[model samples]
Target: MFGWHVPAPDQAMLISGGKSRGEAGLPFRIVTGHGAFVVPVMRRVTYLTLSLMESVIEEACVTQQGIGLAVKGVIAFKVGSDQASIAAAAQRFLADQDRMSVLTGQIFAGHLRSIVGSMTVEDIIRERQKLAEQVLEASKLEMANLGLVVDSLQIQSIDDRGSGYINSLAAPHQAAIQQAAKIAQAQADQAAAEAQQASAQKQSEFARATAVKQAEYQSEIDQAQATAQQSGPLAEAKAQQAVLEEQAKVAAKNAELREAELVAEVVKPAQAEAERIRLLAQADADRTKLSAQASAAEGRIALDQAIIAQLPQMMQAAADGLANANLTILNGTDGLNDAVAQLAAQGSTILQTVMQGLAAHHDVGQQGGAGDRTDPPALGPGPDDDAAR
Candidate 1:
């Protein structure tokens, strides 16, 4: 009494004495002549209805890792698009539902394995509906060739329990970056504060050094003024001492000049009078020399006058003797007169006869022949001769 859930072929049987053969053996007729004879009887009747719905059902006892997926789906199929393939696939694939269902489940499982490896947990959960549609479209071509169809696919839930571990591991790295940023900002602020303090200290030291220099300059000015006041009276006394020395030198020079003028007036005239007396003594010596020359000229004139008085008498006596000796002394004037007197008086009387004879022989020219006659020898002196002698 179990009614078959799948449909089967229909047939009828008729029994008389023997069975029909050939075309008559078939219970159904191609022509409409035997239709009434194959009708079902009341007690022996049977008809089976096989489903034409294209969904293939499969049951799996899978022990997989717990990915938490719950899904239900339906795929529609027909015998292939050609009639020849329809008959072949209907005979081969329709003979058992378990083999066809196992093949279709393997196709769906392959799509799920690829999606799981490539997609993250969040992507799979958020896009579950789109994931089912993509799997259904990919499985349709192979399933349809075996007279199977995919109608609709459904994804009830997708869950990722590993997301908690991913978020927990990232927290420490984020905190480390924030801590480093804060430490860098603190170092920058500290350096700026140190630089400002150093600048202020330098300005303060410069102001103190300038104040010390100004105080020293004022002290030096005060010392210079005090020294000038103490030395003023000493400089004035030295100038007065120089003026007194110049006045003493001028007074001594004036006394020397007055003494020299008195000597020139008194001594020069006395020297001129003494020179005049010496010239008068020289004139008296010249007058005595002229008086001696005049006395000597008078003595020479008297000697000459005495010699002139005796010259004529001596000349007369020389003439008389020359005449008596027959030698004529032709003395001028007085000698001639005395010689003539002697010849005239004595020569006439005493020698006249001898003179005449001498004259007569001379006149007869016999005197030239006359012999060298010697005068008679001197007779004795007469009284007159002796007396004249």
Candidate 2:
């Protein structure tokens, strides 16, 4: 392990002054990717970088038109991954590897000037990639001789050395782009303004239509209110008139009813009382007629009884007078008997006379003459008294 030599992933280890030798018969043996053993005092060891390296070249050159220009470019180069190239780079730059970028820049600077010299300033500016490719092509063999390989080349810029040539070439294109942008912006603004004007017109028309409709509606409302105002008092007056007519009908009906009530309460009762008085008077008249007839009949009966009672006393007085009479007896007994028979006949005549007188008195009383009609007339003595004397 003490005599072992190792290289980095980006480096190659070289060993010299030992039994091991390179494939190209060089003094050093190249080893990469792994370790190698060497005699510690006998072998001399070194390392060479195999990684990417950059070289920037900026140079003043003349174009084909004899115009002075400044050229700037960058080259990406590295050591070739081969035993021959590794041996060549080791023989030349192993002791001074830091100078690789400096020597590479010097090498590409000469090639950039040579390539730019064959082209005009316009050609270099318009075809910068072409210029970089040509420069890289011309330097490829020379770099390989140094054991370096060119990976890519880029032309950064080409200037006309304060002549204002590039700015003048691009001025027309910049103006065209600016003009297109201005036109597009103006079109957009015009469209927005037209749309705003159309919206404003529509709003104004709507406001006008709304105002017209509101005015018509208000007019109709006012007309209806006026009609109602005119009709109010007339309708009320008609209603009051109807009510008064009904009240009058009621009053008339009441008057008729009162008239009928008067007939029932006052007139009917007065007629009934008048009829009762007439009936009472007729009854009293009939009773008086009956009492008068009964009294007349009783008086006639009492007078007849008193007359019969007086007739018996009158017969006794006549018989006693006949007993006291003085008389001569010439056929005395026969004459006496004839006289008695004559007396009896005289009595019968006397009774007939008294009955005739009573009949005449009763007839006079029945004519309603002025007399005490309760009593009978008095009787007198009979005829035939003178013939007895």
Candidate 3:
């Protein structure tokens, strides 16, 4: 185990030895495995790493513009994984593995100078990727000879010695960008101020409108309250008017009833009494008229009977008077009878006149009185009648 060796995953182990040193064509074999053994007296083992490596180069090179430019760059490389390439690398660097980075940097430095010298200062500064590509292409074959592969090359910076060329190139574009930024900021500020003023105006108008509407509502509420307060008094006045109207109707009915009672109690009895008195007076007047008519008829009958009785007496008296008258007898007995007849006719005439006077006086008395007198007047004796007595 003392002479045993194991290689890492990224390394190769080489064994070189023989019994007498040249018995087997310099006695070398490459081993890539976990472990390998070597006899201490007959063989020797060496380990070679197979990892990626990086190198940086800084050099002053002259460009095609006849200006000296400082070029700085980085290169990445690795030992090839093929057997021949690995064997070539192991033979050269097995004694000192650190020499791989130094050799790679020297190779990249020489190629970077050659590529920069073929271009102008502007191309080296602006087209740095093109410069790196050309350097990598040129260094490819040389790195292969050293059992290396060039993975990438990068040109970091290119500068002229203390010249103001780069600042002069960027001046106009920088000034244009600053001017555009100032214009955009001024436009944004103006738009924001206008929006703020419009919002304030709208808020003020809304507040004023709300206050006016509220005042109108309050006025309506007050008017409604006033109307409510007066309703009770108005209703009471209407009720009083209705009560007075009912009382008036009752009084008028009572007056009509009193008028009817007066007509029945006073006027009706008076009218009946007046009618009774008028009938009694009419009856009395009729009785008086009938009584006067009856009396007048009885008196007229009595007077006619008395005048008949007196006519006989007056004829007798006339006969006596003729007897008493003495006369000579010229014709004897015939002449005396003629004188008696003449006297008798004269007495009859007087009796007729008296009866006529008595009837006339009775008629006069009845016409002059209102049923007071209805009898005939009495007659006196005639003048011839008294002489006879």
Q: Top model by TM-score, which number?
A: 2
List, in order, the clash count of every candidate structure. 11, 0, 0
Alpha carbon lDDT of residue 157, candidate 2?
Answer: 78
**Across residues 222-328, which tens digit of lDDT does each residue of candidate 2 receive?**
98898789878987898898899899999999998998999999989999999999999999877865666566666667767876787677667667667666666
Q: What is the lDDT of residue 17 in candidate 3?
A: 73
- Report lDDT (Cα) of residue 264, candidate 1: 70
Ranking by lDDT: 2, 3, 1
For all predicted structures, in order, the TM-scores are 0.25, 0.50, 0.48
Global Cα lDDT for candidate 2 = 0.81
How far is each candidate from the true structure, as Cα RMSD in Å? 39.6, 24.7, 26.6
What TM-score quantifies how close candidate 3 is to the native fold? 0.48
Query: Which is better, 2 or 3, measured by lDDT?
Result: 2
| CA-lDDT, candidates in order | 0.48, 0.81, 0.76
Window of ten residues with lowest summed lDDT in model 3 = 18-27
lDDT of 1 at 92: 52
